[model samples]
Target: MAVHSNKTATLIVMLGALLLSSGCGNLAGHKNVDRGLSYIESHEYEEAAACFDAAEAAGENQRILYRAKGILDKNLGQYDSAVENFLKSLAATSGIPGDMDFDTNYYLADVYIKQEKYDEAVEVYDAILALRKRDKDAYYMRGMARLYSGDHDGATIDFNKAIALAGRNYDLRIMIYKALSSNGYEDEGKAILESCLNNTDPNMTNYEKGQISYYLGNNADAQSYLELARNERDMDKAPVVLLLGQTGEKQGDFNYAISVYKTFLAEDPDHPDIYNQLGLCQTNVGDYEGAVNSFEAGLALGNNEYSKALLMNEITAYEYAGNFAQAKTLMEKYRKAYPDDKDAEREEIFLSSR
Candidate 1:
């Protein structure tokens, strides 16, 4: 689909391939690895890592452990760690299976692609393609890698192959369109996006369509599709709302932004941003009293990163309500709390002169 331009997905895919290719094993190794999983389930990362390490050292399912650890690393923004773990997984299966498992290779390919190792990614993807002729993601991702690597003809072939297998997948189609456009086929590229959106029975996923709409400056349609996708709610339901809120803020639709931010806060109140946004929206609507209340509520939560900026907001709100005495009190407090903030110090100086 639109793919969120995430690096993690590609990394995970490559890591998956390596694990499947090399991680399958005998009884003792499996058992040790299973113990590591148990510890992971208990939220004891250190204990789990230790168990996995033991399993790895004892000739256990190092591949599996490595895959899990790679995923963990990716989630924690340790891309380098993920790459290391994934490479270790690959090395584990280098000669044993005689070839890469399509699944693991697919993940490995994705990871390599994210890391900008196009040739390595293509190598793994090619191996996967050889193993499974109809493997759509393999063809599609390789095509993308090739496109980025200045191999337009090769990229086109892989993309066409992916389309043949997964024609209904709009993401692949869009990539092909872009490739065509880059290769001096601008009319075809434009038509591709338009044709898919206008399809009577569009095989494309919702997010893919959303991507098309977003790029075309149809923010309403883009948001509508994205919201539709988020309705599935596989997790805390905060992410989708947060995304919508961000969009609304960007568009200056403060009321809609407030609604989305409020929904997000309902699920993740600990997030200071929602409060800040709510205060901002209320301030914009001339609801100064409400804005003050919102800032006060956020301050009470005690999580503000830009505490002085937030207090300055409060000062403005107080100035609006003609509460100069309380406003002065807060301004002094702001100076005390954030002495290093030049803006806050300047504002305190300006206010004291008044």
Candidate 2:
């Protein structure tokens, strides 16, 4: 199995911003902080970091500065650096409200989880819960950490607490179900999903139901709901298109996946992820040349940080076409590019023997 990359939690960043807004900082510092937030919204993480630096240099609120720095570092996959900054933010006396300590601790815990330091994550979450006994997100995240650490029974207890606290929160319930199913509690997870499906609320969108069903492994229901949602007026087509391609791929309909990805590319030519999906579908259909082209185009989009899986997929396509020479070359390049990656090291060994 491919090692899935970690994602930064946007909830932590948003909460940090709310905490920052409670600041009594100088005008210039606040202005720079606002600029940093705008840069973050535009995905210019480096620029946001620079803005945070400037705000700090201008004697801004250290709490916001450290929190923003932590957020940017997390997005950049600098987990250790993010943890350092988040700790600093939490330690700062001013700017951050007392209640925001939970969020800052949550951010630190999440960073630890991304780093696969599950013990540290559990510790931080434990501390968060000790401070605020009713923090549902902390309980859920702690459960996730426990699950990752192979403490299924402990995870179940935390999940139960989360469910009890969540009450009628449909989204949170679905998230919990997904977490459970993904971590090997499929029966319990499916039961929750079935209950949700039977008690469908009129306020829920087909897209939401589709995502829920997809996570529940109900492919036919997922496809039906997603297709219905796609046809609705004023709908956002991007995610719908991607999920449709995924559903096709999951159902082993490579041709349908290829078609959907092609349609998506026409609408979003620069999208890096769809290209990887398109390449996978092409490779599955014995279209090695097309797969190579798609992977190349995706690499050309300059998303190196998120392109590890794309690179691996491309190399696999080469191998499937009996092009061991090219696969070996790509594997060597991958090993060089991500020297610390265990998977890349294993791939190098495997390709060398091939």
Candidate 3:
């Protein structure tokens, strides 16, 4: 239930490579490999893990196996294990220089950022930049590391370089603006966003405009822009749908939020985040049963990039429904599933007292 800032989404732009195929010739022929990729795309982490295990046992390249394991472990919140597997992946490819080089290093850096090891993350980005000088992702991610580490000037320089490299990419620029805004350079960020927001060029997508408005705290404008974006031909609906619900919720219109999120669910029932958000909105609107149902449905789908949030939401929904028995049961499950989560332990105590 934590509201994430741009800093918390440090790896958001970096995960594209990790989520896609491994592109290893040696591993491509394995039957289990395709199944694993399919499960990953479907957000079935458990099934993906099983597929990976089978692929590894059938002698998938150690480099590929280790990289896939690292991604899965990271998604499942096994950070230390992820670091270990990523390092193994790197070691497995040491001297090859072409197989798994960029993605392995990038994902390892992402895991370091998640662990708040900013210096380590910067070092990894440095390694990647050394390998390829013009890597825009490395520049952007290193900027995030520097931002969190309080090297604001260095971060600004990196962001400028990234913007130059990403030329005409409105989404990337908007993400940079959000990072700047959330990291204490709000005026500068708003100035940048305002330029894009004022652009009347047909090349400027409504989705980017909505994102800019949302970052600028213009929720009503964001809602309107996102709705128009959704109606645009051939536009990707997933992001626009989610942002519309978010804008409604931000404006404290839970009913409108619920209606839109449910509308999205009708066509895409497997999305864990929509269910998570819908559950929160239901809880806010005193629909405890619906909240619990939504939470449970999301949990049943397993980890969909926000494993911790889904688990905590379900526990909270149970508590809100006055079902302390189910809440405590789920709390125990959460504690076992995420043993390192001190926050959940504290929350368990608080819920017990209630």
Considering every candidate listed, which one attains the maximal TM-score?
3
lDDT by residue (1-354, candidate 2, tens digit) is: 222122222223322334332345433356777789777655576688789878987878776677778877776667778887886666553332366566677788888887889987887777667657898988999999999999999988998898789866767777878788788788887787778778877887888788778877888989999999889998887777778788888889999989988977987788778888899889989999999999999988878654777888999999999999999988876764454466667878888888
If the candidates were sorted by their lDDT against the true structure, best first, what order would they fall in? Answer: 3, 2, 1
Report the Cα lDDT for residue 255, model 3.
96
Report how far residue 65 has shifted in candidate 3, in Å: 4.7
Encode model 1's per-residue lDDT on 160-231: one tens digit a residue: 688779756766676677767776766756776787678745455556666676545577887897788667
Q: Each candidate: what lDDT? A: 0.65, 0.77, 0.77
Off by over 4 Å in 2: 1-107, 110-119, 129-136, 160-175, 303-305, 332-340
| Model 2, residue 244: C-alpha shift (Å) | 2.0
Q: Which 10-residue span in candidate 1 carries the lowest summed lDDT? A: 1-10
> TM-score for every candidate vs. truth?
0.50, 0.67, 0.74
Model 1 segments more than 4 A misplaced = 1-25, 29-31, 34-48, 57-59, 62-100, 171-190, 202-211, 220-250, 260-354
Q: Which candidate, 1 or 2, has the higher lDDT?
A: 2
lDDT of 2 at 281: 89
State how far residue 257 of model 1 sits from its true place (Å). 3.4
lDDT over C-alpha atoms for residue 160 of model 1: 68
The RMSD of every model to the true structure, in order and in angstroms, is 11.7, 7.5, 7.7
